[model samples]
Target: MSKDDDTTQYDGAAGGWGSVRGMLSTFREEADSPAVLRTLMRQNKPGGFMCTSCAWTKPAHPHPFEFCENGAKATLWELTSHRCTPDFFAAHTVGELKGWTDHDLERQGRLTHPMRYDAASDRYLPCSWEDAFEEIGAELAALDPRTAVFYASGHASLETAYLYALFARLYGHNNLPDSSNMCHETTSVALKAVIGAPVGTVAPDDFGQCDAIFFFGQNTGSNSPRFLHTLQECARRGVRIVTFNPVREKGLEVFVNPQHPHEMLTGDGTRISCQYHQVTAGGDIAAMLGLCKHLIAEDDRLRADGRPGVLDHGFIAEHTIGFAEFAAMARNTTWEAIEAASGLARAALLDAAGVYMAAERTIGIYGMGLTQHVHGFENVAGFVNLLLLKGNIGRPGAGISPVRGHSNVQGQRTVGITEKPELAPMDKYRELFGFEPPGETGMNTVDACEGILAGRVKAFVGLGGNFLRAIPEQAAMEQAWTALRLTVQIATKLNRSHLINGRVAFLLPCRGRAEEDVQESGPQTVTMEDSLSRIHGSFSTHEPASPHLLSELAIVAGLAKATLPPNPKVRWDDWTADYAAVRDLIEATYPDQFKDFNKRVFTPGGFHRRNTARDRIWKTGSGKAVFTTPTMLSATSIADAPGRYRLITLRSNDQFNTTIYGYSDRLRGIEGRRNVLLINPRDIERAGLADGQVVALESDAGDGTHREVAGLMVTPFDLPDGCLAGYYPELNPLVPLWLHDIHSKTPASKAVPVRIRS
Candidate 1:
């Protein structure tokens, strides 16, 4: 129980009263009151707004208590009574707050007013919302719209993002970078190339019908606590679960449900993973190929033995293309090559494949672990190849699910928040808004970084996320981002991004998901699309966190009114006041998918958006599932560099993306600090480092130019032999922006080659 000790064993189940204690402690930290208590009770309730945590979908059949431990923590954090007022900023300069930890900055409390950086004062001075909007408008009006970047966070409501996207397009620029560009852009591209859709094929209820589940790369228990409950349910219903990750996370091993009386009282939990394989960092593609190869061999053996074959040849012939070529390519991938690339045994892969062979209905779930690589598309396509082999998709319980990070990251893209602007949306914009939309491909998250550094993108406007901290190579990214003339952030709280100001920086405070967003028309509910492609409505319970705050939709509308040329056709004020009108525009934009969006979104579990891929319809170029046989495993491993190790960034139990809720990582058993790196005992011994040796980790990304983080105390744990792990933002410096996926342009944060300097 020592605050600084890194000796806690990874033995306890994820939940129990530990969850309750954590929840209560977090609530207390938030200055919880009767209002907070009532708001907490309303969370996940029928007809209530959604939790702003992870994107685990709402159940079709609503439960009395549907939220999880982490969800409660997120809610409490957002609803914290403390406010970061204008006086607080006046008391502390931006230069002084620069030294504060990301955790400390967020804990300072909710932002209460609009503020802009004052060069002479060396601080953020309170500014009127209208004045702030006018400043942003003047900047945009002076510059070519293509030179400006408008980024969206994943938590953006569909209504909010629709308006934001409209504003960007109407302003004649598609330089829109979103959080999804960093996380799931590869998931979208790969699925479209292989399975013919960017979304998961399985519904939440499909957990009941799945006979086996393969978890690749993601730590489900910590990242999405509610999803672990789904896994627990699947396990209880006799689903064989196998996980492949570089580290053996506690959540994947054992999970104790706090809601279950027996487990909570007895201090017992359900054993989660039937078999867990510690795949090497940047090795998911090779390992995935290995699994498919073994499956093919097993299918051959079954056919040779005159038993019913494991290969779904009939399904393959009818529903897919390129099987013969893909099968040949898969078999050509030798065990030695796979072992060298993946650091996994041929036998272990065969054993995992055996489970796949036994179960007719299987679901494959993956996360950033697989998608944040140079060959992310290949890694994802490989997973789909494994699923397509058995005709797993288009079935009740069997499919591929890429667990999205944010509550509305998937929804944002569905409603046209994309860098690669589509013609359909352009046509809709022209037809509805009386403006010609831009057709050029715009800057993504990575492109924006390069664009700013190259002096192309002069202005950046962040809709929600901490763009600076979330991206890779923080030092370089900071200089590149802060160099912009105009940087505007529409957010709920003060984060590091706010401190990393530009020449003319403005922080426009916006309402959080937990608070009621009242407009001139009245209290408005926003629409969100969860991970499972279900459209849902979330109505706020607690009043606005600050009287000065505005809804994301209103902010966008205000910006649009200030920036766009006034035309009779564009009803900016009308759309902002009536959010339902925003939804109407969204429905009109995508008529078939968002049909009657307003009526259906307020229902019990909301409405399931139409996924043609789930109905055995292929939307790809081939009009069938296409197999992408990986020609090579290109994700870099630090094996060649003698003193270097493959470093992968992760979120602590208390952290969600760039928002540091606390220093403690309860699930991983670390506390009170974020400066430790988790290395295997074997790696520690090989590096000539002791258990608690203080060291510096330098990136091997750039051409011999050092990018190092010092004072990192090594903590030996159950990580892969040549692997290392550190919490994100701290380790973001070690991840180079150039080291990204070629197709999707996602930063390779999960696989950074770094050397430990003691």
Candidate 2:
């Protein structure tokens, strides 16, 4: 067999010995044995550490090594034995590092010591912490506040996020651009409009109680494997799970939890989905409209029969308004339009609707696939309408759940890490800090890139992320970053963001959450809030890679102290020295939610901030769950030319967000490289294309940009006729910058119109 064929042999099995062997290889090359292991133990415990993975809820039922493949990779990557010492920096030029792959640059290991770009040497030279801070302070203070931007990754702890927010407010700029803008900003925007909150209504435990699950856009088995266990259990209980996505994910079809020893040993994987429907890319609105229309029709029939109304009439009467208009709109919407637009047969949709209506309790879970669209906010709102129609919110078995991608993304947003202006948060800050915060809304990730490219932004300070690769329009993002006066990064390892250096760039080495964080007080613990609004403590099992590395909290405080006017009243140093004090401030700031924050964190599972949705109470202006009338009735497909297909981006099993763990995606039959596109056999024939044919896909949006990718062995599957799919970051350039939701400003990364050229 060829090397590629051998690699494909491991695709979508139990991944037992092969996975262990792969992990061993990764660890052997970059083992975190001594110092790193000692530091890792101090993270996410009651005075401990945080997980470096996505912001999913920490498992309430403790399992040994409660980590996913991506989580394990993230943890190991941080605690790697390899060190990027001053000597290593001296040996490699910034230009040389730029040529490296994402894995190659990170494999060089943990960054040690503060390094500043030396233009003359064309490489980074070790600089003292004090000197680095002094230079950073000088550059930041010199620039107009509006011209400076502070971007944060979700990897940052709450303490660090708080300090960063405080510093940005104090510096007189609310340009607190973050990764959330690129992903779930739509969920936040839509939830706020309909529910008066920006968080999910359901907890992890709610999954156990749900009679059925309606999954939209999210691929749980790969993107969030931990969820597979719950899904598997739900399936065992005979609860149906209906999935709607542009691509049919194999994991969703079948999932075997490796954590379950019995199941793993027996090789008995649970079949997850009762039914899977491949809706057209950007066709969520149509599907939702169809469901709503069916529900409304059912309600009328049930009322006529003298049965209990299908609609939650009592709940609607007491808790919500605007149902009359919304119901009228749903009833008027034609099935022909819904079927034609969604690209699903009317029979298939009605069958799915029957399952939904039959279930007494249902939960709707979505991810970036639903949110990263032109009408993402509307899609979310539509889901809310379906749930509200059945009185699903504020209950044990039903509600909306938007799965967050980053480890502490929810926590970051909870503590004011947003570009959107909030009067309440700003007022509170003013009351506490005695400084008027920036009133104007700041730039998001997309806007930040545009701002930097236009020369409107001068400086960029990223708190732990690979920004250049994360943002769309790679060339423009890189050029804009290089044009900056100063770019400061607080991170564990080298990434593409570090290579795009400014005139005065400082790569500040910081301790990862998996490493022990020791301060003057003692070993410290960080808290992270999960998707379910439950706060959990994380403790690291490893030691610090180097003594010189600083915690994100300490780094933020150090920067603040260096730049801010020296004041006895601020007590910035005290908060930095002891994170417990920072937690105290957080507790004080949100007394209603985080009361006794330090004490509650000691609990194994931690505490949950109560969600009003749990009780079916609508927090909207009318004190009821409201259904939004969509301005458009169908999936807004871009005008494609002859022989063109709409392509959507996907994440492989080995990757998490923008962080690629390995080139092999065993589940999808992809191996060696991320160059192949998943195309329908009919599309292949329609375009006169064959397997292994290298083709350039031209953007149908008139951007004139093209993506070159090789064809794969076409698998005839149940996808929409005109749709094609491929991996992201490689394909992000195909998505136009302007193609985004008006309400959320999240780019339509899931659905970009394109036509293949042989």
Candidate 3:
């Protein structure tokens, strides 16, 4: 049968639950159960390892098992028993491997040795570490450093990211493209513009004191389950929780803590949200504007009645500027425009605003859903605007929290895995290495993809990440990757990035965070910065899977040493031998934050970094929380013709970011399939479609391309009108590479216009 036919047949015969059961059964067979349990126990413990999954902060207080479901799966995937040896590669040609699914490619398991692709044999052959490093060095040295791009994943520890950045600058390239560019770029850009730092203001303990919590575009339940515990506690304390998202997630509705013996025994779950409003895609800025306007009106009423205003007028005058301009803009925005754009009734917005204004303490939390839009930066600004109005910052139970994905993404940025131009970091490199660092602006993830496609990027070296699968515009990324002269990936397992071969491609096997790394100094511990901007130490207890495998730091240092002549001023070997030295250097570079890094990290629960926003201090040029007036009030409709639906990409409960742990999205009732599109019952009827029908969705922007998914089980859902949802990576092909936030360059992964046909 044809691929389309197979998809249709599978959808009809295998019910969603059946498919889920089958996949779970397979996962059980494939998973290394004992190793998973062992690895999970190590997470967030003193001298234990860090989670390799999302960047959700480990609790200030440690748990017996800090591993969430996705975290456990990540650990298992890393410590899999399967191995991809040279002999296995000999049997499978590169051409044949290219035809395999993403699941199949990763299922080949851990890379056993350093291997280089042989075009003549159409396979990868084993090569010695020294030979591989020499070839990599030779290729890198031949190219102008400006043309080379260095990419990092959030999985890289603080030590590895520091080394990666140092190596790139020493090699005279500032092109440090990172995973953050794709996910939380808007948070970084907007927060930095308003505050001196790019991190959130609140720590985990602040949740306990919050009277109200407002979340925009964040799915805390599936994305970060541990947060549910805090939310539950807040609910029990009569704290109000509100959400604004296109879809109502199960986790947000209610959660039964399996850890709570009483709750689990009774099968009782805590009711989460006091109010849940379905905001339209790209409508966050409008909703926020409406709230600000309502606050102003309420304040006027209070003043007219000889009562104190709802706002912290004293704080605003003392700590901020530009309030007049911001208040004017909010007051001027018409209720009609706000209602139409947000698809929220004025009454609903006012209700939410009233609750926010009445609260003694409020916390604003958000995720990628808010950042992956055209007006993402504006959305963040609006959140800050509300916080500033109420003086809800710097105190317990109040602040902004951007829920970042990945274990060490924040740490990577903390240590300089950024494309943002920094003179101090560059100067430090020059002073330490006795060479001038590149001062030119570097490429971001999007720019890197474009450069490679245009043949401007000669070499691609990824420290650790599935770049091919994670990046949007799959075709362009694939083409660019295949066209490179040399590509080197230092990773623990086989991934799609390794499949896209260049003229000379090398895959270097590396040790995972779960494994011990003993060097001349002793058993070493690496530090990671959590989502709350707290840094903690992690040490591995398990033995390395293979003695041949090198640490990510060792591999990076070897490559740098091979590529550059020995510089006695910089002790590369010393840093590699001892991770503490790396931390010392990090402390030296950023003394304002990491003073006495080793001593501070040793403190129980680690240390919280400086948060200027907590003090309501605006670090913008005008020293105020500037309210930005958007040039466009709403996103331009991509639908030129009728019957077009806005497609929002989503991740399943079984998935974490780009990594697919399993095929089932338990809450959504999707199983053994990432191809199905989720449509509301109303939308299905409006489109003259029935349940379990095959359909094709075509991009409305004249891309002239269509994707077919069959057996879609139409179910009624609380999603916005004219909006549909589907899984990402699979749907990534539809989002154009150039379609992104203008300022932050984050792909518009959440909002894409498309039309469905039966």
Candidate number with greatest lDDT: 1
Q: Which stretches of candidate 3 lie over 4 Å from their true place?
A: 1-27, 30-36, 635-641, 702-717
Q: What is the TM-score of each candidate against the true structure?
A: 0.97, 0.94, 0.94
For model 3, the local distance difference test gives 0.79
**How does residue 750 of candidate 2 score in lDDT?**
80
Could you give candidate 3's per-residue lDDT for residues 460-550 as a string of tens digits?
A: 9998888888887787678667778889998887777788888989999999998889988998888888889888888887767787898
| TM-score: model 2 vs. ground truth | 0.94
Flag regions of model 1 displaced more than 4 Å: 1-8, 637-639
**How many backbone clashes does every candidate have?**
2, 49, 2
**Per-residue C-alpha lDDT of model 2 across residues 105-196, encoded as one tens digit per residue:** 88788898999989888899999999999889988988898899999998887778987988887887888878888889999889978987
Off by over 4 Å in 2: 1-25, 32-49, 635-637, 703-718
lDDT of 1 by residue, 535-618 (tens): 888887687888888888888889889998998888989988888888888888898889998888777766888898999999
> lDDT of each structure?
0.85, 0.78, 0.79
In candidate 2, position 126 carries an lDDT of 93
Whichever of 1 and 3 has more lDDT, that candidate is 1
